[model samples]
Target: DKYTGQPLHNAVVWLDLRTTELAKELAKEGGQDRFRHVTGLPISTYFSAVKLLWLMRNDPAVAGAIREGRAMFGTIDTWLLWKMSGGHSAGGVHATDVTNASRTMLMDLKSCEWHEQTCKELGIPPEILPEIRSCSEVFG
Candidate 1:
């Protein structure tokens, strides 16, 4: 939530299993290994992706923000980097590295980029995803 100091939704930790059902639902779409080949991960709550899907489905505020284009999605590293660069008030940097992006299950491992098709399938809007950059890139 680089756009605001206080985010509407709290971070969903990796250990949370609340999205297990959501993952199962996703698996039903293309099997658990649906995105495994591209993301190197299966559809599971172990990643950030399904957690986000849960939020959007169950939380009206989150869904509204995303629908209105007021939401920005990313993992911890992206948030830290954005804040370090001045946050929303200072036109914070909105980006993430392949490593963090990969954990979201939103990235195409091979291209080190957001997988738009997968995002669509999962109901995640790519417009809200952070830019994918190399780990070596200077964010500041």
Candidate 2:
């Protein structure tokens, strides 16, 4: 979705280390221990939240879009699903399976849902988050 009315052609891949500093900041602010306990993952640049934080901090357009409540985020699978179902213009479903959700570092390991507290702490808009779904169910 081009929330900024400007096409965002780039993607911050999982292997991208550009979020390394942001990851460290997150670990310090929220503590690595708590993160592991809730998400069963360490605070690292490998996760989506950290990369998102980096973008929000560095990209003016992205930050503006998010602030305007027009941004959307998802992992590759979620993006693919949205495209397959229908593009944003078609009201595509933004959804993801539990296993894929677990890897995002934004979903609760137990509830398999996006934790509002964590999202607030990270300055991530909950509206941009994808809906959590069962792995076996058809999503959109």
Candidate 3:
């Protein structure tokens, strides 16, 4: 979290299986097409959104931080940017490049924007996600 400069939960790796059942449940709701139309990806635990949702449901510290507005979710690129830029001092830039953002299963494949409806369905707070930036742009 930005407030504490400490991670709310242990870093959930890409292969983590904690979100497997959640992914299956999400898939049952509308299958991969539900997400593929906008995100060009399937509803799977391999993505960031599902992992974050797992934290939201299973980790009290993470959930509380998110509810209290201290959480700042991002992929590895964003974390590097935030820390390299300023990181809780001066001015940390919470942002990620298009490639990284797109893989989160949250960004719209066409508009390159966060898909709000998908976020709501997964109980993900929009604010937790970082600003999406072009890969070639100056991040800091």
Candidate 4:
């Protein structure tokens, strides 16, 4: 099952390209030169992070999958990369772009990495998480 449920109805899925543009504009407007390296997209509620959380709370299967690490969670691009790279489970590339990671409300924006504190605050386990990566990269 693809897990297409009604809760997903009318939900907005933000794309990385669009998010990157918005981040660029926001940085420019704020006159923050450091924003140059703030590549990728800006965080938004439409991303999978929020949805994933919702699912974990309301859907038992998703929660169980997460706990068991049987399911791989990530944005569209990450899913694509995983599939394209031979889907190797052992040492498989489980990762997310910074933009997508930002949307999860789980990563520390400054560090571009998963925030253990944030995970604890959100009641999510940090152990089964994927690594956050730069937006521009050549996937294996």
| Strongest candidate by lDDT | 3
Q: C-alpha displacement of 56 in model 4, angstroms?
A: 0.6
Q: Please state the error at residue 90 of candidate 2 in Å.
A: 1.7
Question: For model 4, how does the per-residue alpha-carbon lDDT over 25-94 read when each residue is reduced to its tens digit?
Answer: 4345444332223323233434454455555676686677666656556666666666566455434466
Order of candidates by TM-score, top first? 3, 1, 2, 4
Candidate of highest TM-score: 3
The C-alpha stretches of model 3 lying farther than 4 A from their native spots are: none
- Give all candidates' CA lDDT scores: 0.85, 0.80, 0.88, 0.55
Give candidate 2's whole-model lDDT. Answer: 0.80
Residue 9, model 3: lDDT of 74
RMSD of 4: 8.6
TM-score of each: 0.94, 0.90, 0.96, 0.60
Clashing residue pairs for model 4: none
Q: Write the per-residue lDDT of candidate 2 for residues 17-122, one digit (tens) a residue.
A: 9888778877787677557877888888888888888888899878877887777788888878877787666777788899988987888888889988878888
Instruction: Give the range of the ten consecutive residues with the poorest summed lDDT in model 1.
Output: 1-10
Model 4 quality (TM-score): 0.60
What candidate 4 gets wrong by more than 4 Å, as runs, is 1-45, 88-91
Could you tell me which residue pairs clash in candidate 3?
A: none
